[model samples]
Target: MYLRLENISKRFNSFVANHNISFSVDAGKIHGILGENGAGKTTLMNIISGLYQPDTGKIYLEDKPVKITSPKGAIKLGIGMVYQHFMLVPQLTVTENIIMGTENSWCLNLRQKQEEIAALSQAYGLKIDPAAQVENLPVGTQQRVEILKVLYRQAQLLILDEPTAVLTPTEVESLINILRQLAGAGKTIIFISHKLEEVINLCDTVTVLRRSKVVATTIAKEVTPQQLAELMVGREVVLQVNKSASVPGKVIVSVQNLSVANDRGIPAVSNVSFQLRAGEILGIAGVDGNGQRELADAIAGVRSIINGKIEFNRSCTRQKIGYIPEDRQKIGLVLQFSIAQNLILKAFKNLPFCHHFLLQPPAINNHAQVAMAEFDIRATGEDIKVSQLSGGNQQKVVLARELAGEPNLIIAMQPTRGLDVGATAAVHSRLLVERDRGAAILYISTELEEVMAMSDRIAVIYRGEFVAILDAEIATIEEIGLLMGRGTGGRKSAGTG
Candidate 1:
């Protein structure tokens, strides 16, 4: 075995994040750690990468017991971790970002280091322009820069957490190929993700974790995605959405020649027109950063529309809207606030949660407890800060708060981005329930598979315009991909055509 973890356990105050989990990975093999949010996958990886020491565990490298005390120590011991969130400096060049810490103060060889890094990138098929500013490169290229950074540090064992969460399908495939090449060249990789298809496709061996315990460790080829989902969630999960044909009702929202600007005052959403009907899910499918955010925000009344009109149904008011922003940490919830407080953010001044000149604590606490139970929020207490929860749990809190009021129109932006299969299924079910209850759902996401599965009608958005609006049952993946890339209808039966 190249790496071994024995009887690992980690605790945070009253909660056990990891408990007696043991797994071994052979050298030069890609090993996958599969689990739902808060299932100890990240915690275990943190322990392995020396970000946190296990309270009770023994780590062995090359069959010899070793102690990883810190991140620098882990790097020295040939371990590196690429987190889900990129840690690149946006203003710095790729070369500068990569070589930030590893330079000699007396004799700096910047040119030589750039050449060496460039060669390493080329050798690994991780193409990145060393001189390009990090922010100028697309997300996929930035990801490659991250990989190169770790490899440049001379790490033999690479740990990646949800590496494809922000990548397009093509980028994901390219990353898989790069990982394969790395493993082929005698590098050990520990892959962590909620995405089972990628794990089943790219990894050699897999470990399923649930509630901080190792439920099973097996070869990837031996288990189906369904089996893996069941193992990770500890229950039978419906991988596909089981919904009847949507009986769309009266138009709930109408956007006429709407144009919106991004944060930089650039026209991100231009001349986009669409109608969202009650009892329907209109999915806006596009590559990331292609005006989806601006359009969604405009509809949700957050972004200012520079041109045109968005008309809500006569009965629908601003308070009747439930907006789930893509960047939940910044827009959706108050991270520093308690979960209960965040839950009541929309209705703190209204009845059931508040009265006249004061707030109502009992009603708020009871509502929060119910929301937590309904949403399956895995936390020790409801009053804890929302930031303390895992990504998926935080998303659940957003969903719980958003959907609890039974809003008429739901603007769900990337609702299931970091969620596991079971959590995704639950979210889908909740959306369907809302749709059935005559709610108009504007489902905006870059996740093609999800948009295809959940949307009643799919609209392909590219460069701020709706290229095609196709029936979900008839749209092909190729058609959507082509439209997303700014290609014309091109002899393919796409959209309403």
Candidate 2:
């Protein structure tokens, strides 16, 4: 075995993050650690990468036990980790970022280091400009720079956490190819992801972790996606959403000639128009970096549009639209607040919990308790900090809070991005229920399967344009894939706006 974790365990206060987990990976192979959000997968990888000291356990590299007390120690032992969030300084150039901590003198060896970085990028099929600033690069290229940072450090074992969560389908395929090439060149890869299809396609072996324990490990080729889902959740998994056909009613939201600019002052969405009806779920599918973010933000009243008209239904006069942003930490909820506090974010001012000038703490707690119970949020109490909950449970809090407002429209962006099988199912069920109750939903996601399964009508967004709209019942994966590519010779369908 190239790497073996023997009885690794960790705890924080009274919560056991990792419970005596054991697993091993071979040399020059891609080993996947599969688990739901907060299933101790990150904790295990952090322990091996020296970010945390395990309460009890040993890590073996090449069958030799080593004590990795810090990140620097792990680097010296040939173990490197790339975090879910990129670590590069935004203002630094690519070459500077890669050679930030090198031993060579900057004044004397700057040119040589630049050459080395260029050579490494070429060798790994990462076409990145060395002089480009990190902030100016696309997310896909930034990811490549992260990989280059680890490779430049001469790491033999690379641990990646949720590497493709924000990537488009095309970029995801490129990443899989890159990993395969790295493994082909005798590097060991420990990939952590929640996407089952990607895991089955890219990994040689898979280890399933559930609630801080390794439940099963098997060859990736021998297991189906269903089997892997079952192993990860410890039950029979249903990969499909069960929703009856919807007879969409009157328009809930109408957008006319909407246009929005990107961060660089370029038009990211141009002259886009659509109508969302009550009792209907309209899914927008697209590659990452498309206008999905801008479009969703425009509809949710978060972003100012250059030219547009937005009309919400008359019944929703009391409650504004609810928006579940793609980056939960940045826009969805306040991580430092408690569950009870976050539950009152938008509705605090206009509630029974507010009386003239005083806030009613007891009423707020009561509302929070009811939400937690209804949503099955696994938190200790209303006083427990939101950040203390697992990623899945944190998402549940966001969902519970937003849905409790009884909004007429819900703009859910990547709602189930990093959730495990059970949580994904729960989210799907909630959306279906909302649809049945006549709430208009705008579901924006990079996962085509999800868009196809839950939507009544599907719109494909490509490069600042709504390229095509098709009925969900008639759209095939191949059709959507072609639309995503925006190639020269694919069937172009008309918009149903």
Winning candidate number (TM-score): 1
Our tally of clashes for model 2 stands at: 0
lDDT of 1 by residue, 113-185 (tens): 7898899999998888888999888778899998888998999999998898767676778899999999999
Please list the C-alpha lDDT of all candidates, in the order they appear.
0.88, 0.86
Model 2 TM: 0.90
Give the runs in model 1 whose Cα sits over 4 Å from its true position.
Answer: 105-111, 335-340, 369-393, 485-497
Residue-by-residue lDDT tens digits, candidate 2, 1-497: 89998999899888888998888999999999998777788888888898999999888899999898999999988898988789999999999898788766536576777888899999988889888899888677799999999999999999999898766566777888999999999999999887888898999999999888889989998999899898888888787799999989989898888899977888999877788998999999887778989898888877888997888788765365778888777788899999999988887886677889678999999999999999988887998989888777888888998888677898999998778888898889988998898889999998788999999988888777777777898888877876876622345654545
lDDT of 1 at 71: 94
